[model samples]
Target: MGPVSSRKQSIVFIGGGPGGYESALVAAQLGADVTVVDRDGLGGAAVLTDCVPSKALIATSDFMSRFKAAGRLGVGFEGTGDDQHAEAHLSAVNRRILTLAKAQSRDIQAQVESVGGRVIQGTGRISGPREVEVTPDDGEARTLKADMVLVSVGCTPRVLPSAMPDGERILTWQQIYDLQELPEHLIVVGSGVTGAELAHAYLGLGCEVTLVSSRDRVLPGEDADAATVIENVFRRRGMKVLNRSRASGARRDGDGVVVSLEDGREVHGSHVLLAVGGIPQTSGLGLEEAGVEVNDGGYIQVDRVSRTAAPGIYAAGDCTGILPLASVAAMQGRTAVAHFLGDHVAPLNLRGVCANIFTDPEIATVGYSQADIESGKADGRIVTLPLSTNPRAKMRNINDGFVKLFARPGSNTVIGGVVVAPQASEMIYPIGVAVQNRLTAEQLASTFSVYPSMSGSIGEAARRLHSLES
Candidate 1:
């Protein structure tokens, strides 16, 4: 920390994603001279290609899924059988996704500019500890002096040498929106969040989907029980899930593609989507020259407050390898700005952060997990209640999900929870609040939840935990 300057502190942000733009707004609002340098449009990859567009496609897929289930709810079309089958128009969906993403980018840019923050559409690099060099697409390169620099360049889809995406038969998640027609038989490689999500979305859209996973189970990084539920749902919905299968490579074969497994087996599909993972975009940013340290995987090293080792330089978002979610990025960005400005700021509490998978039966979790308790990392008791018992779930004919809660053994304080349902993302917030505030299970159970709603299961689980403690 340095002397408090009387004048407005100058801040330069490299990259215009959630981490960059969100911090720019905060820094500007705090009377700092803020400038954001970015190559792509505002909103970065999350808004433009990954999160926003993917979710938009999922929303459409979810609607189609619900429509397909109408016949079970005593709803029928004029014609019977195949005549009533619904189809997803990929062209229209892709067009809408791009349109929505661009509009959001423009909105973010407008908001930043309206707040008196400057945005340069260019590539930004840290030239020194407090200097940024920006090269615009249509203009000459220029250098800007700043009191602080924030690096939030984000990350890119990690490409494997053997299964390189051709943006045609073989595609990365980012290249999926360019598709003019739906894949006939889609082979989704990797069973991580992105792979599981897109695979489920395509399956709901009436495409033949085969999910290939190297791990024994899908969503290997998430809660085990939640993953099992999703896997069961995938199998029930007619998806071919190949576990313990690693894809060696993929190549175009006539009108379709062939994916080779390490076991000398091959799977053919109309298209293959590589959702393997992402690599941090920390290269060519002059980080080493600026004395900013990066890890072996090329992710910028940052403290909980997003400070880099070099003075006046901070890093956040995927580039920091903290958490890849947009919400986490925004929080990290704000924290970095506040810490730099000498304002009140709390170090990031990752345990309280909520994570969600947007499958048909979404899986959302917050705080300590069952794995934590079993591994002796956390001390807590657990109670799980199936959604099949929930009135709302019964009405909706959803039978494949549950709500699990964790509480301290002695105090009965709510430590964590997991929700697997239609809108688990939205439902996880209350549990998140309980975890963040360290509320007791009794407190949570006493809180009012809507009658005949899926959230009631959360209350029931909490009550059960409280009773066991008593």
Candidate 2:
């Protein structure tokens, strides 16, 4: 930690998610008297329920995937293939998941406190400009004055009125880990990133999985080609994927749950997990009364610098209706703090932000998409190289996925790229740098990558793009 400057300003952050706590730490380091008021535990839903929990389970899912393919890799086990009993010890997994989440929450809390920021475990609402009212869990409400305020109240899962979760047979994504037994047949609704990842995870864990999508394909908002590849992989793994089916309602019947589609079709499973989407948690927080602007959907309206309509009040993260990513939230928080402290700050530019979807063949993309090129919004040429051609993929017996690169039409400067492979999350960083820093395809091609590596495909794709100019 650097030395705190003598200059001091009081800063209050509402919500203890990545955006709120991360910014509070920065504010404290900048010599501000910073305090965070949070309703939930530190680290927010991203840590306690959603992102961290899902990824931990995915790590196990990835191992199971590898275990199933051991025979192809010439790796042998003592038991016969048919006699193998590799059931998931779900109770044990849940215990580990909760342990990891709680540890992370405590770690984040420690980080904030170590940097001199005080944390109040309570619900905070804006009483007025520069004033926050905090209601503690077991105490009377108290008011705190601040020179600046950051509202980062994140979001909660959206549930259809007819399909409310019972927490036993029908569960939200947050409620799944509480179950002591693995779902015999898991029916996952909504084929977005959350639904796809969980469906893949449970399927890899040796359970029967069904994925229902309202759109024509899974991951409807994702890159079309990437979505197609994943949907194919889902079906190939014996997971039932029902596309063009909009779920109207879900109900518990006997020992099972049935999700009814709009067209009158019904899918039955031992359990139903809803991953429809999320609604911003900005309502009834004294926002409207404080004269801060929130949209019809309850998302706080903010400028690129994260300022709200009311003076001295700023907003960030999912609640602001910007890009709903953890990294984006952190950057927004830092930007809000810098601006509040009278320091020079650049407004957020979300164009080059990298996003990854964790599935069997993970999907990672940065900057412009294939849709942008076709729509003429971006004047770029695209080149793709399948991972099957890479020596590492062959050595590993991995035959799926590709690396797609995009370059400007004239100078061939790399503007965007996507990677679909196992651990695509890690492989996408170099391409992210190329896009973020405006590095040209020629520059990427010039870079050296180890032979028999998955990353070699990235350089090769750029090399191919460079060849078009010759």
Strongest candidate by TM-score: 1
List model 1 lDDT by residue over 1-470, tens digit each: 42256788999999999999998999998889999998989899999999999999999999999888988888877755666577899999999999999999999999999999998998988886578899998899999999999999889998779989999989999999999999999999999999999999999988999999999999999999999999998999999999999999999999999999999999999999999999999999999988899999999999999999899999989999998999999999999999989888899999889999999899999999999999999999999999999999989999989999999899998999999999999999999999999999999999999998999999999999988988
Count the clashes in each prediction: 0, 0
lDDT of 1: 0.93
Residue 285, model 1, lDDT: 94
Q: Which ten residues in a row have the lowest lDDT in candidate 2?
A: 1-10
lDDT of 2 by residue, 226-265 (tens): 9999999999999999999999999998999999999999
Q: What is the TM-score of candidate 1?
A: 0.98
Q: Which stretches of candidate 2 lie over 4 Å from their true place?
A: 1-7, 79-82
Q: Scored by Cα lDDT, where does model 2 land?
A: 0.91
Cα error, residue 271 of model 2, in Å, equals 0.6
Candidate 2: lDDT of 462? 93
